[model samples]
Target: MKTHKEYLDLMLDGLENTKDKTPNSFSYDVLSAAGILFVEFARRFEELARKFDVDNLEGFELEKRVFQITGLKRKQATYARGLIKITGTVGTVIDEGKIFQTELGEEFRTLERAVIGDKGEIDVKVEALRIGPFGDVDKNTIKISKDYIKGIESVTNPADFTNGYGQESDDDLRERYYSYLQDPPKAGNPAHYRLWAEEVDGVGYAKVYRTWKGPSTVKVVIIDIERKGASSDLVEKVRKHIMEEAPIHWENLTVVSAKEKPIDVAGKIEVRNGYSKSEVIENIKEKITAYLAEVAFKKSYVSFAKVAHAILESEGLVDFDDLRINGTYDNIDLADEEVAVLGQVKLD
Candidate 1:
């Protein structure tokens, strides 16, 4: 897995190694030319390798070909949502797709047609045109596109706009492709429900349980891409998808978001003499976060031993004392619909 830069450095080292001992004619110009040639060739080789798989492909080619073969494509950019106040008479119409921009030039549009209110104040919502985490913006940052709308006093988000997600990553698409190939999604089986649940957008993980409520009852619990509880909208989307795909004879199906169970961590950390205690603590947090991500949807009990090991082995940490998860220093079990998330880490 050597990167292009690393390979280029190796080639340059070989050239230096071959410099004549007696003549010593390794001029800077010759070395610079060699470096440029190595870089050019390495980049071309990298491009050739990218063509080998859907995971490596990018841009339009990925959308047109690789994604088509895998049965999954990149997610398009999503819109940020917020409320806009319009001061106008009831007859006023805000057309769907009317554009707006933030002070930063991020564009947004109304989700649908809206009419003004009789009280001279109407609440309308808009979504950003561009996709990504950028769509999850703070309140009061949007202004109506000047030419289109008049008497627009101000825009404010009543709640956090967090539905925005970036295009699917190569790793994510690869997982879905492999899962589809492995199970191939047929009705009346747990695997079929799991596969269908995962196919929904924004779902990072899914698990299916038969007889969860009673005989002939199926429960599908899901976590979103951020490893948090799936939104109600997402839950409904999954439910509808399952309802349509499930066989007519199948029993009742319930799709629910995983409930978050926060766990607090407390410990006394000792860092080596040359290392900062804050840096060590931060590293411990990162390791714990990564551990949680890996075990979020599949396992019921998080390994307390693994968490202790992560903190003890952090790069700058010399040792830790009395490290406890929720004050017990033991593995905790979560119900089928519950997920564990880090809450607070107190280090002395």
Candidate 2:
């Protein structure tokens, strides 16, 4: 681990006892150049050592290779799917592959062809043209048709979109990799079922209940990447993956979305001098949401102290009084099949 300067100094000191102990000499410049090469070699050696350790590996491709030896792959991103209502003249043909978009230009395509009915409107299924959470739009947000149709008047989504998720992060993938090594899945055990459920894309966490109904019956409840309850489609995806991987006798396995436990926060707050009350409240909500996501499925109850800490961690907050979670200064217990989600932040 010797630095370039240190290596050069060593060479210079060794020459001090010899005949070539002079500054700006041929031998001195040669040794200095060699010192630089030595430093680079040392750096490369250190990086190589780190790559051999699973914990220190960097880059998506390198991490994938390390985990692939054990049959684990990074979960890919998922596309968002939803329904859009198209209104136009009756008998207007909406062909398959028609594109609709949001104000932000996120595109979605019709999955099937349909004609406007007698009511001059029809609901058609659509999938996001691209993967990731950007595809999940709010109700009535999709108003643009990429290609104008002759009789098309308007388009809108009646409900909020769901089930969109980004590709897994390196930290999250590493955690799962560690979980696989620490509690190796084996022989239809609870750990086995938990890992199986989590392997599906968009599933953030899974809780396994062994023998929930009777012997040989298991139930798995899962949440999505945002720490909210999994959509029914995501639940079915997990169910299908587990069934395909489980042994033939594992027909009693069940997969369901976790019930959402909304955590409503109401309090009085003193905002910092340069910050607006609305800004402070929004910051508090962000911190609280991150806290809830960090503890989902990992803790049995939401800590009252942790909730208060989240508020204190807000960037624009000066002080607070009478902070309440779910209208009480106490920890809220979560059921085994429940995941905590941010509800309302009512601040004065």
RMSD of each: 8.6, 2.6
Q: Mind giving the per-residue lDDT tens digits that candidate 2 earns over 206-317?
A: 9888888888899999999888999888988998889898873556888889899999999899999999998889899999999999999999999999999999999999
TM-score of 2: 0.89
Worst 10-residue lDDT window, candidate 2? 57-66
What C-alpha lDDT do the candidate models reach, one value each? Answer: 0.73, 0.89
Candidate 2: where are CA atoms >4 Å away? 9-17, 25-27, 102-106, 117-121, 138-146, 248-251
Error of 1 at 81 (Å): 3.9
Highest TM-score: give the candidate number.
Answer: 2
Clashes of each: 2, 0
What overall lDDT, based on C-alpha atoms, would model 1 receive against the true structure? 0.73
Pairs in steric clash, model 1: 77-131, 80-128
Model 2 lDDT, full chain set: 0.89
Residue-pair clash count for candidate 1: 2
Which residue pairs overlap in candidate 2's backbone? Answer: none
lDDT digits (tens) for residues 1-348 of candidate 1: 455446545555676556552323555446556657777877788888878776666567666654566565554444556666556655677788887666777777788888776676677778777776687665666654644565454444555566675566656666667677777666568888887787777777888898878788899999877677876767887899888888733357888899998878998988888888788778988888778877887788888998887787788888888988988968988887888888899989
